[model samples]
Target: MEKRRLGRTDIDVTSVCLGTMTWGEQNTEDEAHTQLDYAMDRGINFIDAAEMYPVPGRAETQGRTETYIGNWIEARKNRDQYILATKVVGRSEMTWTRDSENLTRQTPAQIDEAVEKSLKRLKTDYIDLYQLHWPDRPINGFGFHSYEDYATDDMVAFEDILGALNRHVEKGNIRHIGLSNESSWATMKFLQVAETNGWPRMVSNQCVYSLVARRFDYERAEIAMREKVGLLAYSPLAMGMLTGKYDSGPTPKGSRKDLFPTFLGRYDLAKAAIGDCNETAKKLDLTPTQFALKFVESRQFVTSNIIGATTMDQLAENIDAHEIDWTEEMEKEAHRIHQSYRSPVA
Candidate 1:
């Protein structure tokens, strides 16, 4: 329920941001509305969504997440009550994201189309934070590690991406800008470009950060500390691996891992680390869910921890995690797990 300043922006967002990536695919429209209502009632003032959501990213259900949020906003008529954040897809082969395209890149024209569609789907005049979903450069994001050949010519340049976002800021379509799945170099370059060009500054970086994945600590943490673009950590529970429900040999039925096995690859590599997390939580007399959720939520460098759930029970447990007092023992246990894993998934 605590709020924090997002970089140098006047916007104040809650440390616990409600994530809605699963809204249309795993959950129905009513369920999405229920989650929104419950989250607001629980004092969560920040909601994060994306244009390419309800994951698995099929052409059929691509934009349903924003539609659900848009309906909720229209029904509640409290758009000003929450800090809304959404992203534009970076270089991707999923061209169905754009009606006439087979490949989507963060080019200026594509950015214009993306924002216009996102605004229409979200039913909002302005987004509090508009994010580049990923980098346009050839890089292994979404957990891929092996290097792939980069095209000699790509559709968009980094500055062009920033320039497009800046134009939106000037036009009031977006209030601020942010990035996700980006490297420390790109983060600093974006900041540098903004400073040199007198364009809008990026307010935050959204990435995967959990007890099992502490790779951010290696370098991104420094960028956050020195550059002021704090982290908006998604998958803070590592897609429910940190919750320990899957440690009894099988992933729980109806859980995220059970529903989407491929998404849990991060946990697959660091399965032992996750087990260590569960064992440590038991030693601390806490549920693995509580321990893992609190461990990420209590981090000093985390601006906000994005929590997702398909059911009310899961949402309640995630929300209650904030109430648990983070003890020294838990911190030490988190560190021990990190030491053993050394970012096995990153």
Candidate 2:
């Protein structure tokens, strides 16, 4: 596995990071530990989780993902071997994550509480990268049904959020800060604020980026190159659609599509475009998984390609894709697919 510099920091993370969102819900603790051990043996040293994980987030499974990782960390006692990353939720109604409030926000108190709980759940003294799951700004959310802008005065400011994170840095609770599902303006503003305050910089942006989701490439790619805050690409497989498993058959049993069909949101809109990418992969004698995963990994602006799996076989296949040599022919085909589809999901 290739390692890349994490932003402008001295630390280096594998180009392929293990994603843990499905651990507690789709998988059990033993399975999560198995995946962790296998991933480390495969030379991957970056792991990412979130507070409200196992996605269809509910109170029952809210913190189970972190607890599973925490258990693995406790048993293995290998905290120094890998970089652990997790996120604090942005503005939302996932109030179960809070102690007293009915809403989650990026306010200093909430950030402090979030970090403290995540530390306890992860069983780690320090988090390598602590990210805001998304911004607190009132804007279009995932697979938006409408766009509405609220008053600017209604949200937590960037400096305050970074300031809260800085306190964690000072307390040796987290090493770096990052953004997710963030926009260009906020990305730059955070950097500017950090520079002004001489605070820890926003080192990366974890966002939805894949063959069918190239919105990051349009503008943020340049910011990544010049500012050194590269992307932590998520959903690189288009939620497994690019794997071609769903290309021709009924939804596989025990699969995400079969269990929680709504979680595959927005991908349904780009069915034809996804088909083009997957079909093109077949024509080139490549597994659609390889083509899709490599496409995200190959991008210059990517710090790490976060891959998730519910089973060992899927884990192996995703890890194997990292070894496939990306060819010029493949790049051209990815380009052709993008031009035809124009990032329909974004």
Candidate 3:
């Protein structure tokens, strides 16, 4: 794999980041270790994880993904070999992430709490890139729309959030900071705040950017290109929907759809566009998975492509997708599909 600069930071991450959300839930520790080993062998130096992961995030299994990575680091004793990135959960109804306070905002205390616990769980002294998983503001996310009255609570201020991250940077617990599921306006605001306050600048924006989900290209791609906050695109395969296995109907057994039926609600809502994209890929003589993955990876705004899988077969195929050279015809087909769907989920 190739290396790319993470925003304006000195760090260089692999173009293909190994995603670990399914590690503790759908896979075992050995399997997680195996995946890490394979990814490393393939020269993938970027590994993304989260504090509340192994999604379908339960109170019991919330931190298991980090724990599995921690175990891998301990067993391998090669923490410095890769660039590690992890995230702090934004405000959500899942209050089990915190204790007794009912606090979900990015307060200084909460940021400290999240970082320390994540470091402990990850069994590492420092994270290469620590990310705010999403905005604390009230917004329709994860494909839900229909705007409600925008009420601004006394949540953590952007400056305070950066301040907290700077402290972690000083302590060497986190080397850099990043954002996810954020908007272009928010990205510019964060940049402005950082520039004015002389605080740590955000290194990247991790968001959903697949062949079917092209909303980022509308606005945020410019932020990435100009501000150096390149994209760490998640769900590049639309939760395996673009893999062409689900087009034949009733969800495959043991697949992501079967395992977490609600996981790909956004893709399901835009199934027509996804079908068109798959068809276009077939017409172009490319498997839908290869076409979708390569298209996302080929984006100039993309710093890295985060890929997840429950099985090694899926993992291997996804990793192999990086080898396929994206063609202009693939881009044209992707654009045609988007013209029809035009962000049905968003």
Candidate 4:
């Protein structure tokens, strides 16, 4: 229940942020609302969602996640009590998000349309932190580990994207901006553009960081410390791999891995590393979930750890992970695991 400053902004958000990407796909509306109520009661003050959410990204259930949050806001009338963050889709072929195009890009006009729709769906006048879900350039995000450079002239300029977000800040539609699934070079480039053009600076970079995945620690950690754009780490549990549920037996029924096996295929290469982590947790007299969550929370560059769940028990366990006292032995064990695996899931 500790709060941290979001970048250089005046807002102080909880270190644990409730993630709602499973609202409409794996959970119902009522379940989503119950999760929200319980999270608020537990002192979580930040909620993160996206326009192209409830993942699997089908045309049928695209925006239902925001609609669920909107209904909760309408019913509770407690919009002022928490910080809200959502995202706009970057360059992709999932064109169902927009009305006019078959591809989604971070162009100025597309940003305008995306922000308006998100506001209407969230039932809010302004978003505390609006994020670009990914970069406009052609790069492998979402679990790929290859690097390929594309034609520079083929992509939208970073200045145009920041300029568009600045217009939203000026109009009171968004209070701040952030990035997701971005690289260190691009993060610095965005900051440079903002400083040179006198535009809004990015407040955070939301990415995947867990015990089994340490890609953010390589170079972005320094940027986070120096530039003040700290990390909002998602999937800190490695998409349920760190919970020890899969270590002993078959996949549990209705779990994320069971429902969408292909989505978490990135962890396949790190199966041995994950099993080692679970064993390390037991040696430390802690559950794998607690160990994994605390390691992400203990990082100096982490602004908030985004936790998601489809059931009440899972939600409670994830939130309670904040209470664990990080010990020296735990840190050393984590380092041993890292030295052995060395970002197997990255």
What Cα-based lDDT does every candidate model obtain?
0.88, 0.93, 0.87, 0.95
Q: Estimate the Cα RMSD of every predicted model relative to the unseen true structure.
A: 1.5, 1.1, 1.4, 0.7
lDDT of residue 108 for candidate 4: 99
Highest lDDT against the true fold, candidate: 4
For residue 292, give model 2's deviation from the true position in Å. 0.5
lDDT of 1 by residue, 105-212 (tens): 888988999999999999999999999999888777777556586784763766788898999999999999999988887899899899989999888999999887
Model 2 TM-score, all chains together: 0.98
lDDT of 4 by residue, 1-346 (tens): 9999999999999999999999999999999999999999999999999999999889999999999999999999999999999999999998999998978999999999999999999999999999999988888887768788889897899999999999999999999999999999999999999999999999999999999999999999999999999999999999999999988778899998898999889999999999999999999999999999999999999999999999999999999988999999999999999999999887
Off by over 4 Å in 1: 144-155
Backbone clashes in model 4, listed as residue pairs:
none
Per-residue lDDT over 1-346 for candidate 3, one digit per residue giving the tens place of the 0 to 100 score? 8789999987888889999999888899999999999999989999999888988889989999999999999889999899999999888876777775574777788889999999999999999999999888877667845556566654567888888999999999999999999888778988999899888899899998888778888889988999999999998988888899999978788887898887777666787888888888888888888999999889999999999987888889999988988777777877777787787655
lDDT ranking from best to worst? 4, 2, 1, 3
Model 4 gets an lDDT of 0.95
Whichever of 1 and 2 has more TM-score, that candidate is 2
Superposed Cα RMSD, model 1:
1.5
Candidate 2 lDDT tens digits, 88-172: 9999999999989978999999999999999999998999999999889877757644457789998999889999999999999
